[model samples]
Target: MGDRFEKLQDRLRDWTKADLPGEIWHSVDLFDQDDYDILVVPSFSVDQQVGEKIEGFLHYEERLLFSLIRLRNPHTRVIYVTALPLCPIVIDYYLQLLPGIPFSHARERLLPISLYDGSLKPLSKKILERPRLVDKIRRALRPNKAYMVCYNCTELERKLSLELDIPLLAASPDLLHWGSKSGSREIFAECNIPFPDGSFTVTSTEELLEELYELWLRQPDLKRIVVKLNEGFSGEGNALLDLRPILDYAPDKCERVETINALDKQLQNLSCQAEGETWESFSKRIPKLGAIVEAFIEGEVKRSPSVQGYIRPTKEVEILSTHDQILGGADGQVYMGCHFPADAAYRLKLQDLGLKVGEALAARGAMERYSVDFITVQHPETNEWDIQAIEINLRKGGTTHPFMTLKLLTNGNFDYDTGLFLSQQDQEKHYIATDNLQKEQYRGLLPNDLMDIIAEKRLHFDSSSRTGSVFHLMGALSEFGKLGLTSIGNSMEEAEEIYERVEAVLDEETKNYGDRASSLPLNWDKA
Candidate 1:
């Protein structure tokens, strides 16, 4: 139980911060100080270097963690992985919504450039500033190749990688094709699987309305009409186009239907709720970079599974696990959290489908660690299970380390004979990092701040005193914060319990900072 995230994108980005509660790693300072090579990161274009604003992106700190291994052993090589073009349209969306950003001025005239999320930027924008950002990095990291930009292999990525002489990871464009709603539709059709009837693309509302009519004609009992962007994430760029009440468009062409007046009434009703994300605004937010659209399916959220595979040598390993995205609630929030394997009933099926999908993707020139998400539902009439693809995240997903951390911590072995991920008696329990540091400001508190707080909260883990009933597995915190201070414990419950304890410590420190701010020195204005 850690910070819950409202959006999945938020969750992936926040994991880089140091104070993530429940995580075993205490401080990022240790990670920074450690000498290593090959730092994997998100848009090194936005990284901070040894102060001085580090002037142009370098590497996301999380991927930079590998510097730890390299520092310990210089023979190590690091590979940073990047993903698809976010969307080539979201740029205008943000400008329209939050006009304060610098890019707002030129938004109106941003022709020939669509938005793409986090794909660095649209080709046009990148073309404008590429020289400056690239030049800055070239100067800063020139001596011995400080870092490499593992961009997704889109046309831009390919061009950039060639110019920089750095190896790019999964090409965004090709992988993106696998993630399209239409792509998924094709896959479903080939597999003879059932999915919500959907249009390949709907550029205008006219086409949208027409598609709605067609779907209605095909399946009159359908209750939900999901609208999705060509490229999107989490649940963004999606809406339920409720057409039940407003189905009178082109009534003459079909059997008797609701009148035009009813359609107008429905539009009026929609106007009341239309204040949220608009098509025009939502369209631009598509990504100053890359995005895809899809049909939104209705059902309980299920199976946040990822099938991990690596391609330099081409190996496929499907670690099918269920995940709960920790979307820190509204406002500036933290995004990250706990993931475990899927439920018993559907675990096997999920893993199997994931393998099939993963292989299919890898075969189509997208042969790396690709993740495909799906939701399963039962046909109302047949009661048969149906697993529908959600979106394919063809990159290293959140499930990467949680499962690996579990592997590193576990001493037990799995039994292939039993077709189980672990042996029958293999012990599997322990961990805690759900320490919420945001509720309370993380003021000037040092590493020991949390340990002391957990002690006060009576949450310290003592291996010798630990009973299998309370806690059973363990590791020791060698440093504990910043530059690699580690925390170890036995039992997942104990790990979680300790996290809660230290959370209060963060809260306390934040409160102290608040007090200090209010009572500052009166003569402090000399500067």
Candidate 2:
């Protein structure tokens, strides 16, 4: 098995370095390709505990990316693998949205296979456990050149590629460390990019405490600090501390006892990333996965803008898109959704920083998609924003699906120079997307029911005006009462308006279903 795995790695290298395929290049004319095959594996690819709650619906939400299959030529096949079967109605719903493609033709070319298990384990693990399912996938391969695309690549993904005799079009698992919080900070420094004042790769609470004290000494007026898990996603492994109380005392008066006491108190009261998580549980996790403590960049005029980029196998770095993330939580540290192309005022600056980071990643042999997150603050005196590179996600993140949805649906490209998305028809495009439009009343509502409401209310995307809502997380709605959506329009205001209308429609339709709203705090915009 080890020898076979090594052989598979060699094949993957050859595939990535193979001669050019004009059709595979992502552009407005991607559909013009004559023949090819794309096998999409939308695994959460995170720790099992982090993905536990949403295991059943993770792949279902990725169906949003399947919208790209609609753009493929009839001769080109798309194989979408999932942990469980997708709702046929949901499949039909997306197929009907393709502008000029006939539903039957597209459906015939698209294939969805599942493992028939909805357990809390990672989808890759589930696939590995089901040998019959793996064999089924192996048997479906065509003679044409193919590429395996995943939500993120890890050890399990590498194993799956060997089993299926396919090469992943992503970074090798050996490069996984580059995506961690500690690695991100190192990369930032190596590239000469500006980052926050913090210490990374701290393995214990003691080390973290020492680092905090060091930072406090450097900046006596520090108000807060953030401690993050090296591998946590969507802010679930993040915790914050208030440093104001400790700073209140003079240097001689500030004793270690007093400092530790204050730190303990703040940690116990932190707003953890996971629901129902206590300081006891979170503390245990910190040592196991490692953590980083950094001085929180605070300002009344602060914003979190992220830049998405990709390095092809050939080492060419491409800036994909930028977003102004809408954060939530007590200190606005958790990710919600985002506005596409970021805020026009500083998007170009964000892109420049992103490029520096991307070049560094490419130099290190990183491939496929990665995103650099930043915390930008306005200078009170000059009104100029100073951007601080926060962390790098070497995988698909909250911004990936939304941006891909817009790109595939409209056949558009993000213009890095102008910070705008232009569709194939040369129309300007924008969108507001979120995965947190969740409510208890939304429970027990199946995909079919949601489709009915969309049809009756006429909420489908309007081809004539190029505006409307597209829904995801349908599987979660029936059980978890969670739904995700992207509202696309010609401008930011229009997109936001469309999002508001969609929320209103869902609220009105599902008002009486299930119990009252969950007691858990809303993670997204409640206003």
Candidate 3:
């Protein structure tokens, strides 16, 4: 079945190559009034166990709702599939953001299909299991004129693409290794990119221990090491190992067997980044998912910045944007959100390094969106930032939708020279976005309730000014007290102010409902 599936995918890839025009692949305007059908299956398609750990994981499907902006092209139709039906209010919210296009006209070209199954399986797999749903999607799409887009591409996505006879506008499942922790390290080495000292991929507790010991030998002064699952996302699969307790087992101070034994004993003390994660549960996943160990780069002042880029079908690489990510968790490893147009000092440097990585991936046949994360530390003396590559996300990630939303809203383009996004009116645009605006007080606010808040506060994105708030993850609000939003403005300070205002408004509205206040800072500087 696997062999046949691969052959089918290869054939489909060839057909898609011949069907789509080369010029469309390189153009900044993706649809550009072109006649085409877009099949959107926003499936995470990750390890179900890991995915289930996230609160309101299914609602993440709404992240790609930004794709609805493509409907503005007039000649394009979109078919969006989900595990469960989306709220009409949520759909209406997105459609209303379209500039110049009439609401009824855009709705006419849109089709939102739901499987009515809220099971934990990937949405693509659910669709595959239902022959009727598969057929429904196939019948909706125009043969030879449509392509599928997803949150991430896996074997399930490939199978779905084959079943629908539509090409997937993502990297093939076979090349997914490039996105894994070990694969990322290999690419960094091949590209001569600087990364933390790390171990090769390991699949067993014993191998992991040996690698940890070796890493300790190399960096005896290392205070901490990060253990990451090869296939983790959003930093959930990461754990930190404190070396202070095992300092006596150092290479110079102790023998090999003693050091190894001490390290093995300390495994139970690993500080996991994921909520409710334990060393026992984490280590159990090693054999199935593989793991790696790397020295944790430590500094008094550090920033997590990432660069997003795209690999066109023509194999040309384009840097899309750069952002300074806001992280949280025990060790500041979990992704919370981001500020666009990364700090001026290193934004261009990020683009240069990102281009190298993208070119490398494109040379290896990677396509569509990819992002490179980095750890930048400031030098006390020179006050210059030292940058080190971290990992490669070979899919549309947290930064993708917000940047896409900004582009679609303003009809803007990323300025390569300045690393700033320029609107069609030549005004600079900035935004602060997050999928983690969660609060206990926010629960029970239905889509309609949220819409009312938006309307009353004038928080809704203004099509005329092309600045304000754009929200997603509306489905999660009722149950999880969580919502996602992108606050846009003409400058970074204004963007942060907008985000703070939104946070304040939500807090004021929900104040009487919950006991605890949100931990998120009300000011950007404090954050």
Give the top-scoring candidate (TM-score). 3
lDDT scores in order = 0.38, 0.77, 0.88
* Candidate 3 structure quality by residue, lDDT tens digits, 302-373: 999999999876677899999999999889999999999999999999999999999999888788899999
> Candidate 1, overall lDDT?
0.38
Model 3 Cα shift for residue 6 (angstroms)? 7.9
Assess the local accuracy of residue 53 in candidate 2 as a C-alpha lDDT between 0 and 100. Answer: 33
Error of 1 at 507 (Å): 5.2
Candidate 3 positional error at 293, Å: 0.4
| Candidate 2 lDDT over residue span 88-195, tens digit each | 887787778776778888888888887777776778788888898888878787743566778778888889988888767777787778899989999999988899
The full ranking of all candidates by lDDT, starting with the best, is 3, 2, 1
Ordered from best to worst TM-score, the candidate numbers read 3, 2, 1
Worst 10 residues of 1 by lDDT: 467-476
> What are the TM-scores, per candidate, against the unseen true structure?
0.57, 0.90, 0.94
Model 2 lDDT-worst window of ten: 23-32
* C-alpha positional error of residue 405 in candidate 3 after TM-score superposition, expressed in Å: 0.8
Reference-based lDDT, residue 484, model 2: 79
Model 3 spans with C-alpha error above 4 angstroms: 1-22, 27-31, 513-527
